[model samples]
Target: MDLPVQQFRSEVEQGMLDSFAALQEALPGAQNEKVAKLRAKAIERYGSLGLPHRRIEAWKYTDLRNRLGEAFPMVRPSGGPIEQSEIEKALGPRIANMDAYRVVIAEGEFRSELSDVQALKKAGAELRSLAETLEHLPDDLEPLLAETGEQRSGFEAARPTGRSGAGPDPIIALNMALMSGGAVLRLGDGISLDKPVHVIHLDGSGEPVGSVTRLIVITGKGASLNLIESYAGLGGRGLQRNALTQLVAGADSHIEHTKIQREEDEAFHLSNWLLTLHENVRYDGFQYTNGGDLARNDVRVFFEGEGAVMNFSAASMLKDRQHSDTTMVVEHLVPHCTSRELYKAVLDDESRGVFQAKVIVARDAQKTDGKQMGQALLLSEGAEFDTKPELEIFADDVVCGHGATSGQIDDDLLFYLEARGIPEPQARALLVQAFVGEALEQIDHEPLRDALTGVTADWLGVKLD
Candidate 1:
């Protein structure tokens, strides 16, 4: 006789289910029938799937289920007043004074007082909080939420074959079940913004808590805009953050997107980015990650129409025992599309870094051109880096390739700098900077690029001349 198999549920997993049950009614859009049904389905999916672990190939390196031993209780914003100075200080000098339309989200809730709402409106942009949008659920939201059959089928088909096979993402499911607040921005056809829009995320709760936030951006035909997202903590302890951003670029639109993640060292940060591109669209995206005790960045890009171009790059700096993972999937569903990806990572101390990227070209995507590369620089013997680059093409005419490299800094380069009278530490820092600079240079925005360069230099403990 075979004994019954016992199912094991970690504290974090159990807490998530319990929290959803408790907060379902209080969650945003709880009264809307459609939103209600969506949340119910998401929670059900989460219950069935549980948290990701080593058994899943995508999560093999980062065992989130075991790493996040205990879950922090979900906390609702108190609607308390906050000072602008606090926001400025949290953003630091590099980003605080940037000339951009600023929007502030604190503790998972949008703070209009801290945001440039009036200015944004005057600039002919339609902006609303997720809560406000949910109150009167619109038709466009269903697609952004990944509820459409087409979107779902496309994602399922593109996913790599492994133990995790086509399963719903637990993190995304949990966020959909518990999402309370976020921001949504829409630009009409032919509208062009004079300045970039900066969304500032600040974790300021005094106690340990779990927060979920979402950002949705929709651009109409021929529109052009620059968007920046920055995440920082205000002396928060044990903050568990789950953030997601959905971006839809219309035909002939041009968009430049940048993200900077620098949460507190003790926090757990999980972020997902979903991008959809249409015909004749141009998109450039950059990400810089250097914070959080355990962080994972998940990005998925889909080419919906022909003649679209996408350029993506990222840089990560990890020290101590921090674990950082960057996973991306770019799917070419149509012909005449182009994509390029490059990633750089610097690991110090006993920190570990992981980069997994996959590019898929469908049979009909004949003219698709894609290339991806991931490189890492290890600073110490204990530092670790793992990279997996894959290309799956169903079309023989498509041009697609991928490569990954991991190694320490070149002693010859370091010695060359030191021999020129540079201090040992400074020389090492310069070498590391040059390694990551390749990715940083992909950012077209001068000020933003400069700021990120400063961030990279600071991480190396040396100022660049």
Candidate 2:
């Protein structure tokens, strides 16, 4: 007689354990000995650590253990390439009109037929599918895939405390075991992408299915590029999405990036972005959300050299018991670097919003300048907002500050708008837009900014002629 398998405490854990066994046996990467070992290590670490919960300070507000109930197995491509009609139905009205070089990921597979890979290559950029690369990973991939810290950045050692695998994040660990395909964009030295590259993820399989999509973007010295990502779930039940984006800015490069999410009302969306910047680099990034029952965005940034600058911003519109969390960590390891972050949210009904940020300055990282702020507008008495801002400084010469605030809509502003012939609903919409627009304006790209503005209009029910 065989002993029975141990039971987990919750449905989510049991599902994860069940899915890991299935993915390890069926996924293509299992055939490769090196990749197989990596996957096994990741799963083992995840098992030991379990789901990030309120007990951990970093994940305190967004309790994955209590909230998630899906086992969300890895998706495999069963049908043919996604058709144009399907893409249209999935993306909705706002992102469809944007002029961008589109890359499509459907049913956990990269759809080359629907992508503009050829145009990107012609413009001196390199693109590849992660699944293809996994079959024959290059030896030099380690340097491109190094951990996220510098010589003096706090927590310079490898992550997960003491895990051995392709990465430290538990979600990324599960992804390593079952990820089907993703996108990779690399720009060589002095190469500049003229048009923005847009990555679109469509989840509309009409059933409960979850998949991991990974995107790696690297810019060589003196290079410049703009990248955008959109995640949408349509006509589906029990849809879960996990995405990981890795960004490396080479010396003297400029990178502008933004992420927009508009998934199904009951879908589960989780994303993580790891960014590393070198000497004299400038990074501008943003995130805007309009959908999801449970959504969390985690971002981490590390400065590798001097004279680097970063401007990070995010905004969310939530209602009807929705939960949205934005978590970020910034590490300064070099001298003369500056980073600024602003987050805003508008909550209605009984929705909840969370903003958690931590900035660490090392003893050797002198002359570092960092500031962070979180602000939220409560549109209803039942809405809830939580914020945590922290700064850890070991250097005597660095300057860092953080602040957070949540309050109801201003009466004076509402009255002023209604007095100017604007109806009560319209006046509320205008005020909400103005409140979130402060952070949206940080993105310098005009067209992208305007496109996001259009999304805000839709959220506010504003009519655009």
Candidate 3:
């Protein structure tokens, strides 16, 4: 629980604890029972184990205590109607043709004009605001919501420790404590979405604000859906966005989830994505983080049945003094499951990048195939990248391996491109793209991939001829 000796203990950590203590007192007994229970449990855990510091193996590379040394004021939920232009401006040009509607949350409040509730209704999809949905969540979904921090039943074979209790995470606790608005999306059985649904979280130039948003997605058997999430902060200093997404994919269903973060240079961002895949289900994810003072994305995926497949890829373009971390855990619980993960980071100026990936195959999960790779390009003298890729396979018949590489741009490729009359900046940009293009190729949608390419080009400050 003690912070690294180099840095002073976090006062913000204390502030968060105090805030939770106050909230437990202010909230009525029946009104906030669930959250109160979670907070109480978390506090007890914090008292016993404290926050997992950099000493913890799982948090060695990116020291969260250093990032959250202080606390900002919590964002209140009183706001005017949300605007569509705000979403457009934040999304910039990453958005392609979206037949699926959108849900916009501005400073922790839902914006109607930015969402397409009517369209979802017409398609037999259920789209409800978190406030209303939580009041009447279906009985079947209640157990799913329970933060059993413990591993899922099917995944128990992967981690023999049998540690499956979901305790309070400071970051998650911060989100639950301050959450004011969010979205709930559900797809009916056999329904296929014609377009990808986009959710935009935007912050404005106001008092330093702290906000939390939650999203829950459920897919029925044989259904398919594509979901895109974009996060942005407009001219803000010291703003924080803590977001969480929990997805449950049904049998024979397919889901593609993409997250794009381009917040202001001074803002802070933290996000967690937890996904559970059933038999014959497929899950694909692409995450892109381009701007932030301190940003971290944590992803956890579980394979619960036979023939399930999961693929996750990420591309990060960091510059200046920015700091970004991508941490993921993938577990194969059943036989015949497959997973592949590839992450690439491009660092320039004095920025830093972190990638930590772990893949686990259970003893009984024979024929499981899992592969992981993390590669990085340091474009400037001060840029840096740290990677940790690991595989713990208990199954004797499983195929599992992982590798990591970090180095500067390939001089030979740069020279070859320059020899072709490509200028230095353009040549470097092209080579960097070539290095990461393989991951982009995994994207099924051409337009979206092209949009991401454009974003990369812009990040490199090069205009393709």
> Could you say which candidate leads in TM-score?
1
lDDT against the true structure, per candidate, is 0.86, 0.80, 0.75
- Alpha-carbon error at 354 in model 2, in Å? 0.4
lDDT of 3 by residue, 1-465 (tens): 331122333577677667656555542222555645544654544434434457656667666676776667667655665455555576674562344467777777666666788888787678887766555656665555454334443444343121221233455545555455788889989989887888878777767777778888998999999888888865656777778888999999999888989888778888888888999998889999997898889888888879999889999999888989898878787899999999999898999999988887877889999999999989899998988887777789988889999899888988998899888988888888888788888888776788888888888788975
- Best-to-worst lDDT order: 1, 2, 3
Candidate that beats the other on TM-score, 2 or 3, i.e. the better one: 2
How many clashes show up per model? Answer: 0, 0, 8
**Model 1 — TM-score against the truth?**
0.95
lDDT of 1: 0.86
Listed in order, each prediction's TM-score against the native is 0.95, 0.93, 0.90
TM-score of 2: 0.93
